[model samples]
Target: MADKRLAIVHVAYGAVGQRQNRRSLSFYFEPRSFNSHTHGRDSANKEPWTTRYGAQQDLGYTGPLSFSHFPYTRCLEDPSQLFDIAIIGFPFDTTTSYRPGARFGPFAIRSGSRRQHARGYTLTWGTSPYDLGAGLHDCGDVPLSAYDNAKAIDQMEAAYTTLLSRPVLGGTNEAYKSQTAAISLDGKEHPRIVTLGGDHTIVIHFDAHLDTWPPSGTTGQERITHGTFFAVAAEENLMTNTSIHAGIRCKMAGIQDVEHDDAVGFQVISTDDIDDYGINNIVKKIRQRIGNSPVYLSLDIDVVDPALAPATGTPETGGWTTREVKRIIRGLSGLNFVGADIVEVAPAYDSADVTGIAAADIVHDFLTMLQLAEPPVPHKGPFSLEDLKYP
Candidate 1:
């Protein structure tokens, strides 16, 4: 039954929706197949996603599920049924003040990731992504049209609501319930989720899903935030359980109304904290706040110090560096990372794919981290930074 289930997974692999299907040049995520998206279709030993961590491989023995098969948007199919991770695109950039191409981010990321997603890599967590057998899905975009800001927000809210509902494909077997529903019903597990972004605002939508996390009243936890996203999520009541962002920036003046409860616990990783303790100390502080919660990490490319990733719509100057990010993520292996997304990678800004490549490598790092085993072994020091050595 398990083998049959696994085999059918390939055929069942599909995207959930289409973000930019237009004219005759439209592109939608479907079950992977040979196509132009693959930069090295003919290579005999093509390995999809890779970084210094190791080569990319799914938990099972199937070959890499290319970008062709990635970010599945066809709702009729289910990528989550097979792979555990997804490389999402959030092309919405309205809320951002800096760049507009972020609205076109999903497309650019797809273009850059074509070959990588198709191939995938293995991680140094001493495990294969395939061995754990993760699933993949391209949920298309958040459907923002004509720029009716309120309407766009509504659609975004609806999209994430559906995602968290744990929609089920056509099946009524004993485990037929959607993965999330199954977890809620039978005490089984649901797939973890990692969303890409149209902008940092997309994190607000996920609030409805993760806000009630840690089964409520669990224990200590921090809150997550960055300038605009911080305020928006705070209002939405989402950052609470995540135990992210230790400080609420002064720039976020009026926005704190988003999710402000007196007992909201967890401090925002404040500017003062960073000023006093430095990023390294802040990183450890974040981990301590969360203790052990299945995390859904969302990296707005802006988090990478402006010096590193300037192409983003919101480039905060004093953000963490690539070196700092490597240190933090390396320390974050064991926590149950449900899913992740690297939002706001606008390629139209700077030099040759600098931000795009950076974003790609970050996503690669995320996947490798996910490839770690169940009871996670402790991470001693920085991971083999070699995986990210390339562009």
Candidate 2:
């Protein structure tokens, strides 16, 4: 009787395996044919499979990795493919003084953006960047030499200049009509760039450090590390005096750093100013300083408190909160942003991708800032009265 029971169990298992095998064979050998519906054919008689059949969409976790999963294109190599806004990566970090992992910043930031999709919308901004009429594309990273800092800097500058020279692909929306004209420099409308930085040094202004240290004593090769690139930019006339630096809390060599920062054409906004002056006032100050001149906003990851965003080459202890930084960026929406970058996110130093997420969110804000034709009107909650009593 026991032998019969075991035999019965074996037969049951064998039958189940046979059924699975048959199902697998049927799936592989099933007759397949494409009909009009399957091929995306329509009554209008347009070419079948020519248009809607090949639509490419990516889920948050799956797809070719691009900034916000924007369609990848070699716009620099092929100028014929025009775009109003382009996301380019600068994967260079030899210039960084404190840390070396920022060279992987672009990849980390892109990975963090995996959650963002074309359909995603920001309630605060009230629009999806992809829905904006402007043509947006990921232009890939500018190839740079890791061994040569000077060569890399030149490559970056040249790449930026090339992109800046391209004509803007005007958007379809009426509100977006004026942006191209307003952001035009040299009497020609140019494409806006949102760069993924390898380090904080690539920025002209903003972050914990003033980043405007003069290269007085250093050799030509040593002159242009991440710490002093802004000074080099100032010398090269790459930045205007209207630029301003916010969230500065780095240990300065002396008062000369501030003086040099001023000379390099940046007004300083210290990290503590957020506590004293308030967020609205700080935004007002930034706008007042920038004044209508084409703005290039660059945010360093170290600008945020190290506790919240610790994956940066330089981590300053006391810095602005991520919320405060986002609020400030949101407030500055109406400014003419020609380009922007979020830099210095070293994933090796990150605990649980907090820094990378912050950087990606800021980049989302950057996109919104660039696409917005006007500053977003403040939201009034249901609890707010037309005339609320304040104690």
Candidate 3:
């Protein structure tokens, strides 16, 4: 009986060994058929995987960084890549008076815009900026020297001048093209620039303080801090006399600062004026002040109350709320805006990224403002029963 059991066990072991040997041989040398359809090689396939290598639709969390995830282009270096509107970054903060972190403002603003997409729609504007026919692209940041304020300022001015000189793409929509015609000071069709700033100094002087401080007698680097760049801009003829400032609440050295600000070609609208005159009135005043001239808008993040947007080089307590500022900006839609910048966003001081997010949303408004042929129609809320006439 023992001998018969041993023979059966040997036979079972031999059968298992034979099956294992066959499996190992098949693993190395099995003949397999390739499915052309699965590999994207089928001639009948209408859409091929190879053709979708550079799709613009991107998930917010992933992908290379750019404002609102617009296609990145070296438009400044290569003018052939045409664009009607370009977003550029100026990352220099050596000249700031109080805080020095605004050099990182552009990056912070871009990072905060991660959740925004070009195709995203805004209820307030009733349209998506990308839906408007405009060739918008991110021109990336202008290279600047960190150690030299004078050189940095020169670089910024040169970059702005170059971008302002570029011809518009005149997108497929004829109405938008016509609306943008002759918007430049030269009475020519020119691309609009939305600048992400290094400091408040680089704008048309929107902030809690009057940036048009009289140039100190001393020349060189001492001459061009963030507080005095508008004075430099005025000297360079970069700003028009029709320019204006809003949200002014800074402590001043008597009324001479106001006199100097006026001489620098900026009409002042104090922070308190918003409380007294209201948002619509402020927008009306700005629109009337700017008229049809090519307007360059410079907004300092400190324009908002410090409690709301504290990540700025200069913070004043009594300032406009982010909503108030956005409302005022939305109201200024029909104005001819050639260039604009939101500056002084130092994210190091930010809490939960409120300031960066505010700056990003403001840029979103900038895009909508640039692309709109006319001002957006205000929404009539559902609660407005006047529209519903009882039968």
Candidate 4:
């Protein structure tokens, strides 16, 4: 005896008659025929969405799915939608020493961002980032060559560079387009980049190791890793020595590593300094050291105490709380922050998605800072420190 069950799924976009803020997709399933195969497979007692790719037989379900489903536009579909700032996911965690689950950081961060759509408006900054006139997009994650570390780093660098080359003003603030268009970096204009990290190794770390030095006597593959990406960034002139590192609590490779980091052009502030100087002084120090230079802020989740951010690769104890970090981040407004990243969130280790939620909000702060920053006026003469300060 042959027995089968048929299921029909209906997918609809927008509402019954409205189209303006169509954010939800409705799905209705109806079962009918009992003898036909769903998609070349038996239809008896098996889930229809079970195939090589884990996708259901094509019944066609295209609604709306994006970072937050608010102002959704892809880079390929409309490059003009990407401007001022763009979110790029670097889902590579191959160089992690203690934990390996940070590769899932991007997915967790995006998933956690679902809670942010309702309040994209920032009360602290007194503005909605979406309404600020800067072009924004969820350009999606960068596809990395999984096995090759060097190639993966190259891919990240190239992908970032490509996005940087795009024009920065085209959204509602088209009136200011001519003004901001004149904004240049080292004689070239570039869009700012906000990266969702895979691990602490990808940028800066919070634990007792600095991944800035080249592995001694290395060849092709050994030359690059997540920890070494910043070294490569220096080689490529992606950033300058005026860069700064915060929430440093880990031990270093050696005293020379300190010299190496100094040579690399970074001034680091340890977590203990917060106990001595407090957050306000820390903010002032960062602003003083990084004066006027374009900035790229890389925040490792481990920078927070393990109690607050346990889902990281190598967590050090006695770190700052989420509130403290957020305050510091907010205090960083008005700096020439061209790019930033929040990395090393391993959702598997999280208790109730706390780490992921914290990361998403951190990224939200980054966007807010970009919006609050004073738009660059056309440089009439040589750029000076006063030019970087914002109202």
**lDDT of each model, Cα atoms only?**
0.49, 0.77, 0.78, 0.66
What TM value does model 1 have? 0.57
lDDT of 3 by residue, 1-391 (tens): 1221111123454577787765444433433332222354333234545674546556776788898888898766886866888899988888777877987889889988888784568778898778878888899999988988778877887887787777787777565566567654455677778889766422334689888786683245387777787887789887767778888999988887888888888888999998788888988988888777767688899999989998988789988999898888888787767678899999999999999989999998888887776678987577666657786
Worst 10 residues of 1 by lDDT: 201-210
- Superposed on all Cα atoms, the candidates' RMSDs to the truth, in angstroms, are 15.8, 7.9, 10.0, 12.2
TM-score of 2: 0.82
Each candidate structure's TM-score, on Cα atoms with residue i matched to residue i, is 0.57, 0.82, 0.80, 0.71
Residue 109 of model 4: what lDDT? 85
Off by over 4 Å in 3: 1-57, 185-187, 200-205, 217-221, 237-239, 385-391
Model 3 Cα RMSD, 1 decimal: 10.0
lDDT of 1 by residue, 1-391 (tens): 1221112223543444422222112212222342356565434233334543476544322433333335355432443443234444445666544456777666655555544543454343444332344455555665575366556667766655456555333322222223333334346444445555554411211111112122122222222222244444545665554456422332332334324422344345544565688766866776676665545666667666668777776555666566556446655655555557777777788566667666665665665565553333444566677866876
Report the CA-based lDDT of candidate 2 relative to the real structure. 0.77
Worst 10 residues of 3 by lDDT: 1-10
RMSD of 4: 12.2
lDDT of 4 by residue, 1-391 (tens): 3433323243665465544222111111222342243443344334443653475322212224344444555463455565666787888888765678887888888777775655687555566666778777778788877787778877876887678777664666543343234445355445677788754311222333355665442245455555665676667676566666788777665688778777766777888899899988988888787666555577888788989878888778888898888778777776655578888888889988889888888888777776565422222557788989995
- Candidate 1's C-alpha lDDT? 0.49
Local lDDT at 17 for model 1: 42
Name the candidate, 3 or 4, with the larger lDDT value. Answer: 3
Clashes of each: 65, 0, 0, 3
